[model samples]
Target: MADDIVFDLLHSEIINYALEQTKTTNGSKEVDLSVVEYIGFAAGYKIMERLTREWPRFKDELDTMKFICTDFWTCIYKKQIDNLRTNHQGVYVLQDNAFRFLTNFSNGHQYLEYAPRYVAYTCGLIRGGLANLCINSIVTAEVQSMPSCKFHIHVQRT
Candidate 1:
């Protein structure tokens, strides 16, 4: 349905545009971040459009921002991966039970060394892009023990 349209638009249309952007910068061979960052920005831009459309008169107040970030991590992203957590801070645990149910999905064969850094990069992609839309935030990740993935994210309202 709607997902089909978005998939076509992103893959068929937006993907070509992203490729052209890479070529203009000369193949992204010397600079790896070029390609990844391009995809990140494009995806981020599209997401922002959807966010604005869904919430017309967006007010980036503290409580409102908290709700949006929590909803994004817990509901949208968590569904795609098993055992995702959106817990922030200590004691209060402001958001005890978060993330509504959705289709379960798993990450692909993630590399051994990069599993944690990869997660951190994703967090930055989402957080940094959102900041472009006047939503100030920060993201960090950590994977301590090998094979066992552990990711931590710290987000603040601004």
Candidate 2:
């Protein structure tokens, strides 16, 4: 029911924001890569909303989050972004857009001028909205960091 509540909202907002972002910066860029990534973030943010509603204890652990991310990946992203629209015999289409949106966000963002910091900031944005309604605290850890980057995400108590 909640999925029905949020899917179209997430879908439209992400596409609209992606289009606005592309127009503001890349100047008429298509929704090839970056838009997909942005959509992933927005969709992930939404999915986290409904998901935690079912699994109440899912929070504040690196490995648990990784597992959730993995499921989210396989069920949503891997077939599309990792496989990139191949007609590979074994893959199935994701039932929704979560994969296209987040996978792109994770990968495409790596090329930004300040990739690590931007991601931390991104985590903040995602958390700012969902922390109270669904989540308690966000725990994000960058896979890599630079001396210039002061970003780190760790567990926070509710």
* Candidate topping TM-score: 1
Q: Give the CA lDDT, 0 to 100, for residue 46 in model 2.
A: 69
- C-alpha lDDT values of all predictions: 0.43, 0.40
Instruction: Put down candidate 2 lDDT per residue, 21-90, tens digits, no spaces.
Output: 7778867644333444444456566666555565546453443434343454344324321222212332
Clashes of each: 0, 7
In candidate 2, which residue ranges exceed 4 Å CA deviation?
A: 1-42, 49-66, 79-112, 117-135, 139-152
Q: Which residue pairs come into collision in candidate 1?
A: none
How high is the lDDT of residue 146 in model 1? 37
What's model 1's overall lDDT? 0.43
RMSD from true fold, candidate 1: 7.7
